[model samples]
Target: MTQPRVAKDWYESAGVRSGPRRMLEEDREFGLEVFPERLVPHLAHEGLADLGAEGRRALLTQHFYQYMLFTSHLETKVVNRGAALVAHGEVDIEVGPEARLDAFKIYSDEAYHALFSLDVVQQVEKVTATPVLPYDFGPRMARLDRTVERFLPDHGALGHLLQVVAFETVVTRFLAQIPRDEKVFRVVREVVGDHVRDEVHHHAYFSRFFKELWAGLPPRTRSEVACSMPHFVNDCLRPDLGPVRAALLSVGVPADRAEEVIRDCYREEMLVAGVRDAGRHTLALCETVGAFDFPEAREQLQLLGLAD
Candidate 1:
């Protein structure tokens, strides 16, 4: 019997060598514009202060493990999808030069976000009685598993692009709303501001990419995508409610009301609003890219609770 071939590491794969190098070069140039050298340490310190010693440790631990998993998945997506683009000679060397530049800038920003998160996790772990890694929470673990299975398929270029749009949109909004503090909020503001600039372009790229994919699909496939969009939004917006519930329960909130309490928090509101914003922006992007009509797409987005 033939043995199944193991998937190779995306970064190390032959397909990723050139594209990543090109991507990296573009990033280096973009870095000159938004390095955040003056902002990161302050933000890191502020984020640390927001979490008490225990909370800081827990947050950092969660960020460390989650980022590792997320980066692994992203590397695979970039490598495989990039390889396919190369094979098809679909690489947009002309237009791609600009897109690659923007993507590289965003990638650099993400590295800082990941490192800051890891720092918090490590510090929290050292001081907390019971530090909680991301996977320690049931809902988060379940979502992570589901996300990997559903969106991280063998060939998911469109899905990968959507993932970027979804995440960046939320991060942008979340950063915008965090209460300003000289130490903490300042760093977040600077980092998020840089991210927002790059993400605007990233969102544009995904919007264009999705429209092309949607246009090429059969009518029936387009219908299927439209129908499935709500579920996708739900999955994307659902929070790690387990920890929130536990925190509430620990404080003597009734078990039945714990979930409700968590849902009522500002964080949940921000999540819903962010998802709605992404949905609207995505549709607008589709229109700009010449993929679909706004009226029709608006109806679909409304069904997903993204439109009023």
Candidate 2:
């Protein structure tokens, strides 16, 4: 049997020796001419050079802040709701005060993540003088949340548990990458790196919590949640290409070329591959817990090419 990872003593386990990190003036670069080429798949599109480095920087700058905006809003939902479930206890199981305290630590981390992600957005805004445009989570997450709410109208603890566990377990894909790429602004690297350090702990905490929560479910409820898990996982994994499309269009990318670029950038196989890689940890947990043992979940997984 695998030894379960512990979430307690987050300060030590999370390796956050230096305490919290934030974007500082030293981390800021004023009017950097080089835009992050890897910000999207449209890297080095035919129009970028014509956009010029400054123009390219502006577009990518807007893209950067808005991306943070959308995600930060949603993390509040996942973290707070998960915290409530932990604190209040669930249908068949109580997470207990000790566990709830740990959950609160995650809540603390996630809330700080939301706040700092906003601060990073503001930092970009101040430096670039470009405000975060009106952007929601886009169609994918909106639809997924609506559907999940309908499926589990009560936001049942089980439903919330599965959703939070699955997402937090997998978000390392995004959190881990943004900082490592030195192509963008120094502020981005610094802030996102700080965020990632905390998420390393959150991912570990949630992965451990997920297994325990899943094990706690009653058998019949487990089967029901199992059937719903794939759809939720797919929703969690699906990328919102719409934002990228709109970004290209706003940049005066030619209409046909914009559509073409979006398609080329997000090929079906490539998208699937990306999610399979990104969500590997969560998918594996779901599988070990027999999420795919049910026919409906298996079918969904198969349709996503995640299973046979």
Candidate 3:
């Protein structure tokens, strides 16, 4: 592996280094939508779209709650753990002290993200009076587990690290749109805005880390792992339709209609485009590291329609 280098001016420029981010200030005027309708695709379904303003508002609020739910889980369960492993040298890579220190920063940032996500969840629950419906990480984790078993059965910590790399590097539209969208509530905008700022540095750190890690892997192992990249990219970008369906049902849409709405709104083409667009940076990073140097690796990604 190439010698790992510390990110440039991380302590001075990182959002976490400035001091703990201020907690989101609740807006007294809570009537503004907590999430933009454009961010939630299923809301565009004809039946769900016709639910009128108040109904749409409730669904948007619930979608925001689910967004926090995803953030909290991703920060605590996925990113933090991966960052902790790197910081402590528990992972397979041999990173420099500077790299480990940056991983510690990532770890700290993600934990703070989880706390604020839950805090917003509480504030929104009180303000909107929309009870958070049942949500679970089981199915998501299970799908990931199944994918790993199929593609990299003995991956162990490598699997975890790869998942972290995928999520950190893949910028999703939902995260990008929330802060600048004036239609979203002020508090929600502030919360996501804080997150987006931190992620900018985190993205750079992980991109460099992935290149270093790929340089360190054996050629055969590299080929095997590269085959799984498209799957991981899809996992990172695909919308969690389970929660969307539940939110729809809770908001009084019939179960049948909810399923139809999700299916219609998230067609195969739309999903492929979302995954490709969101994962473009990750794919380019892999290409930089020669992850697709082997014909088989390129073929695997092409089969997923992620590359030409």
Candidate 4:
């Protein structure tokens, strides 16, 4: 049995009481230039390509926009929605008052996270003056929704809940790295770090909740969710070269150089490093939830190099 976490402390630890409250001003310790290195393939970092400071900066800033956008999307759509279902018993999963209370707290946290992520984006825009990827705002979640519907037409919420559980269970590791990564800007570090603190607690919450949800679910529904979960995880972690390519072009990176960057950056080895590792937590959690117990799902995850 998975240990149940005290949900109330998570509410307190969301940093609403105290943490980076003011807008991030441009500062010397954390300049825009140094924010997280190696936006492209390791070749660029290894001096195989001359992307220049501006090119690298543009790449990182574009990546920052993606980071914030996804964060907001997750907090609002996935986490918040999951909590709402649990709190209101809209889904089949039954909830006690204590669990519902905790879910409400998470509901608040998710909303705040969504709001704060956009604020960080604005602060980043002030410093970098780069285009945040608003165009990407809809496609990712939409893709997941479409895929889930195709898989479980009658029970879309089951897939959504599974995906949310998968992502939240594993997202802590991804969020935790940002705060400690000295290469990123200080404010950005603080922003992600603060989020990480909450996610640590969230990881616990989702892990326990998913176990309960899975136990309550019917066998056929569980089987269906197991099959569909990997695709949702893929949707979350796979890096699209489209935005990267556009950002490079916007910054006057020659087309040939941009192609080279994309080619080298998205190589099979790099995909394992960036995409697989980014979603490792999700994969593991999915396995625990029996998502990978199905033969087809296991095969799919293995094909994507996500099978452990």
Q: Pick the candidate with the highest lDDT.
A: 3
RMSD of each: 11.4, 3.6, 2.3, 3.1
Worst 10 residues of 3 by lDDT: 1-10
Worst 10 residues of 4 by lDDT: 39-48
lDDT of each: 0.41, 0.66, 0.79, 0.70
* lDDT ranking, best first: 3, 4, 2, 1
Deviation in Å, model 1, residue 13 alpha carbon: 27
Give the distance in Å from residue 242's predicted Cα in candidate 4 to where it truly belongs: 2.2
lDDT of 3 by residue, 1-308 (tens): 23333347657765556645444445544556777878778777788756887778788888888878888888888788788889988877786787788788788888888888888888778867788886687777776666677777877678778888899999786678878877777777787888888888788878888877887888877887798877888887777788888888887899888888888988888988888999999999888888888788799788878894
Segments of candidate 3 deviating more than 4 angstroms: 1-31
Ranking by TM-score: 3, 4, 2, 1
- For candidate 2, the clash count comes to 0
Clashes (N, CA, C under 3 Å) per candidate:
6, 0, 0, 0
Q: Indicate the TM-score of model 3.
A: 0.91
Q: By summed lDDT, which 10 consecutive residues of candidate 2 come out lowest?
A: 1-10
Model 2 quality (TM-score): 0.84
Total colliding residue pairs, candidate 3: 0
lDDT of 3 at 173: 64
Report model 4's TM-score to 2 decimal places.
0.85
lDDT of 2 by residue, 1-308 (tens): 03323355666644233445556463445544223556456656664457665556667766676667766866787656866677566434556566666666767667777887787777657766755566767575566666567556654556766677767777545546767666556777776777777777667767777677678767666666766666666677766776676776676777887788777777899878877777777788888877777787677678777773
